[model samples]
Target: MDSTKEKIFRCAIDLFNDKGVSHVTLRDIAEKVGISIGNLAYHFKNKDYIIAEAFGRMEEEKMNILSGVQQIPSFENINNQVEPLLNISKKYRFFFLDTVQILKSYPAIKHKHQAYVENSIRYVKAVLDYSVGSGNMSPEPEDDKGLYWRVATTAWMHLYFWPAEVAIRGKSDPDIGEVKKMMWGVIKPYLTEKGIHNFETIKKEMYASA
Candidate 1:
């Protein structure tokens, strides 16, 4: 990306995070980038174009984070996943916070976002499968093949909306620690004794490293 274009992209993200996406205009982004609207347009045709580019980068960023997951699941690996994932959400706060509006307003973005979300849910299910196969997590109960799918969907829901939930409550955005706790809470019931032990060990290491 050109340096100037990158500046405009970054400035737009920050403004969208500060003001809701619907509240921001191309002019706002241009001013924030210290460039004129015409120059900004030269880089991005319009707000929708900028949003499309932003989501494209977001997909790439998320893929990088998911690619770090190990073949064998462990609490430490889960920690590695959750922390950066939450950081991404924070960095692109408006995406989660204004998801409904964005989807409604941009048909192209909505289709892309839905596809990305399905891939993400599959990633979560894969982690669960690895954890179960490794004896860290219990098998899904009651012969329910859909158990993993439902759990993965629920986890994605929390991951997608937790930031928005916090913001709507007028609370300061949560740190990774808080978000991690909520994530673990979602999966904790399915953890085996070994899983619990691994979690505790990782918790100690995480704090020590911090």
Candidate 2:
């Protein structure tokens, strides 16, 4: 069962994603949740408080998806991660669409956002390392510190822009499932034959599960 605070948090994400952060206020969230202003204030005193909680909820959802993965992650494992993350990203589209403005408005968000960025980099590095360990990738320079950072940084750049790209080109909101497919291009060049084989397997699994 959701507590009043949890309901408010979810309601705020919907409101913010629909009307955008800049256009939303505490009263709007309170009204959407069918709670009085005083009741809402009893939980989240301000808009920033609700926004931060919403971001925390995203992190928690990601953690739940990852928790089901194998110990030594693989290309297959990464597919498990990316698809759900994309869904969550699309669900909270306003956060990405208006990210810059939110950051500028609430400078404190940068700290938590940086944490998410670093976590993503770490996951990318782990996948690379696991590939080399499993003989699915070249044992040479691919896992070297410089190369690892370069690839992860570039990969994250693509993932980060998924929604921003849609907004920038004034493109129709493509289906999230198809948008997730574009991630394959991000890391495809570096993959070995074995890596590609494993990735294809994961792709099939994603299709079956979908």
Candidate 3:
């Protein structure tokens, strides 16, 4: 990306995070970037274009995090991914902060987000099943209700809305370490004795490294 375009995006995202996206104008981004609206237009055409690019970059970073888990899923491997996921959410705070309005206003972006969400849910379910097969997680009851689906969906809900939740509660933004602890709680109940042992061991190392 051109340096100017990069600056425009950085400024736009910052403004969007500070002010709601609907309230931010192209001029606001241009002024923040220290460039005239004309110069900003030369690179981005409009605020919509900048929004698309910002989401594209966010999607790329998130995909990289998902791809990092190449090995069969385990408690340790899943734990490794929590921090990166939280980092992505922090970097794109505006997206989660205004998720409903953005999805309503941008049909194309909404479609893309839906596709990404499907993949994410599938990934979580896959990890749960893999862990069960490997003896790290306990199996669901014999009735085999949608326990896994519910767990996966609930975890996704927490991750997607955590920033907004904090804001609504009038709380400060949490560090990744705090976010990781809460996220682990989402799946902690499913862990078997062996999994709990591994999780306890890994938690110490993860926090110590922090």
Candidate 4:
């Protein structure tokens, strides 16, 4: 059973996803959750407070998923990590779909989100680093460390915003698997011959399964 706070958290996401963050009020959340405004205020008095809690849940889950992958990652391990976080993103679509204000309005959430972005970049680069060391990926040009981060950031951008991008495009939301393909494709250019074979084989499987 969801506690009152948990109930409010979900109700808040539903309202924010529908009416948007800017338009929702405390009373609206209380009404939806079948709680009085005074009762809801005990948990969260404002949108920023509620959203920070929700964002905390989302990031905690994402970090927990990333933590399971270990510091070293193979091509397939990297693909596996994306699905978990992407599902979390879909659940809290408003966070990505209508992000600017909520982040701006809540500096702590904004800062933590920035840290998550950095952590994701580090994770991807670590995978590439391991792949390069093991001869599964091409070496960075002149051993330039910046190159890895650039590639990682490109991949992260797609994972972070594919849903929001689709929303802006007025297109159907791509499935989590499709988003993974788009994400993997960003770094596909950096893979070695063996890595390419694995990438292609798995890509087809994901496409087929989806």
Top-lDDT structure, candidate number? 1
Clashing pairs in 2: none
Scanning candidate 4 in windows of ten residues, the lowest lDDT window is: 67-76
Q: Give the clash count for each candidate.
A: 0, 0, 0, 0
Worst 10 residues of 1 by lDDT: 66-75
lDDT of 4 by residue, 111-148 (tens): 88888889977876777788888887889898576888
- Expressed as tens digits, the lDDT of each residue in 70-169 for candidate 1 is 4535668767787678778888888898899999999999999989999988888898889899888899988787887888788877777778888888
Better of 1 and 4 by lDDT: 1
Q: What clash pairs does model 1 have?
A: none
Name the runs in model 1 displaced over 4 angstroms. 70-72, 205-210
* lDDT tens digits by residue: candidate 2, 1-210: 999998998898888887889888888988889999999999999988887877777777765665444364766666667767777778788888887888788878878887877876776767667777787766557346477667767776666678778777887664555544666666676678888787787677656655
Whole-model lDDT for model 4 versus the true structure? Answer: 0.82
Give the whole-model CA lDDT for all candidates, comma-separated.
Answer: 0.83, 0.75, 0.81, 0.82
lDDT for 141 in candidate 4 is 92
Candidate 2 ranges with C-alpha deviation above 4 Å: 64-70, 140-145, 170-173, 203-210
Clash pairs, candidate 4, are none
Error of 4 at 47 (Å): 1.7
